[model samples]
Target: MAFFGFKDIDKLSEVDMAIYRYIVDHDEQVPLMRVRDMAKGAHVSNSSVMRFIHKIGYNSFPEFKVSFKNENQDLMRSQQNILNIFTRDAFPHDIEKTIKLVAHLMLDADNIVFFGMGGSGAIAEYGARQAASLGFNSFAVKDPFYPLIAQLQNTSNNVIITLSVSGKTSEIVETLNNFVNSPDTILISVTGNIESPVARIGRYALTYNVPETRIHKYYDLTSQVPCVYIVDGLLMELHNQDIERQK
Candidate 1:
């Protein structure tokens, strides 16, 4: 059978219960505390501590401490994320101008293309569906290797919306740069970095100004909450403008 689960209170003996209680109550201290200290604090012997360590499936104290520290970091990061994200002031100072510009572009565009990757890719899909629901010819291209959707014609009446937390994705920057200088084909990028390549190339860039976050070297765990807010704001602006025209 597998070792006693953290929640297996019934399976935990009295000594195990003592160890579990001390660890939970002193979580922040346990990672840094010595094994003998843990035993002393838990009111158990050192051998009891070893038994509890194996009961929880860790072969050694250092191994258990590493796992505990990672969990602690995750907990702290999650708490910080919740406490710090999404306030009215977190939006761009010139959001009014950006929204109006996006609205104007959508009204004149033949089609809307949204571009992004990973977490931002999901946001691109959402933006396309939302814009389409508002009566725009909208589609999302998440694949970095997608074939040319259409020729890069000046005044082609096309608009592309890009979502990138860093605004540094090479495929998006290279593809959009070819069309940014042309008239009637607008590029609107939503990013956290104003100076990033994609943002620099955009006709209009809306930024959230949040710090980038990554849980690992290759994976970006940055908050996309601001991107969602900006896209919704833009689509709503277009929707309201369309309503005004009808009346």
Candidate 2:
């Protein structure tokens, strides 16, 4: 089976999910298929296939194929590993409490600031955009200086979310440290390492642990997936809360 099956299908766009479904239904042929071949079978463009692979956390088609083969060789073991990875780390009961708390904070906050660097920075920007779409006043600060300034200017009604895969990025840690004693502003950290500096200092930390692999040494993948998933879950919960209040 393709490794993409391990991801949350609801997180995919309609077109991407359609392509993913096609691949899942044709699992027997997927290992032998090329990007172009998969696109043809799914009636999607080659670029669509490429995007789908990246969205599902693979850096490239070849990387995806190799992992798919290894995972499929021992499907039961692979599925269990995936289940443990997500359930134990990503969707644990504490994550629900964190999302609920974030939803409440966002609903009442005057502003929301998202901070990160590198791949985590990109995910931070995406999360900020998602929050804005959900009607929150949000800003994404990828630069270290901007977050420092934001922290200096924002009041207690502000909410800050920092994204760091390792939770030990120096700039992010320093930024969180600046807010360590702030009484009014709330800090939330989304990270892969709960014990890292940023997570330890934040008011609330959402942790998602993906097993380190040989592929990770060469390609920074899967780290963003859990972050994005947490952001989406928070947004969805906030939306639901809003609808309930309206009712």
Candidate 3:
């Protein structure tokens, strides 16, 4: 197979070659698996896998895998390639799966509550706003303690959507520890790390593997843009679901 999308397969470094070979070997698999697994198979690190994907013209490992499998070949091939323009395009990553997951959760939910701190908190608010516009009952609680306590009461069977990219924010971590066991509430975590504590606590977790938009790396709030995009996409699906339900 073509390594790194070019004829110069031998030009790649050992790390890149390992990742490339792994992708080619597993390109036929269905449902697309994680880069972590592939890296493990190659006995390489996750960062090395990501670098390999980037070297191969993909923005992220997820994008690379999506193209590699060609399982949804028509949809994958037909769509326009999305390129990130640094500050202009903000969320250059495609978070469609995360949105779809949230939509499905909302479809069966009685209520929805959002939790986050700092920029993730803003994302929580954005999600609440979008859900509200769709006539869904929702709240974005920036103050952590009340929401945690509310979950314990079990008065409403709401879905608690926690926005924590790293999945280790103090507020989110504490909230999960306090509320994860609630019988009436379902925990939905939108985070970058699928293996983090928040994801572990969540009833459903939508994991984003974008290392490029490291929100915590800088002082700016741009990292939260991905969360906003995800919330918006979820709202679109929720609107569709509502229309279907009404019809």
Candidate that would win on TM-score: 1
Off by over 4 Å in 1: 1-83, 149-155
Name the runs in model 2 displaced over 4 angstroms.
Answer: 1-91, 150-154, 213-219
lDDT, candidate 3, 89-196, per-residue tens? 333245455566668778878888888877788888888987887788887888766646745475667788888877866766887776667777888887767788
**Colliding pairs, model 2:** none
If the candidates were sorted by their lDDT against the true structure, best first, what order would they fall in? Answer: 1, 2, 3
lDDT per residue as tens, model 2, 147-235 = 46555564668888989888877877777777777777789888888888888887888888775444748565654677888888888
Estimate the lDDT of model 3. Answer: 0.71
Q: lDDT for every model?
A: 0.83, 0.80, 0.71
Indicate whether candidate 2 or candidate 3 has the larger lDDT.
2
Compose the digit string of candidate 1's lDDT tens values, residues 1-247: 1221356678889999889888888888987899899999989899999988888878898899888878777777768856667787877778888789888888778988888988898999999999888888888888877764454443378888889999888887777777766776788889989889988887788888776777768789788888898888888888988898889
**Pick by lDDT: 1 or 2, better one:** 1
Candidate 2 structure lDDT: 0.80
TM-score of each candidate structure, all chains considered together: 0.66, 0.62, 0.56
- Model 1 misses residue 100 by how many Å? 1.6
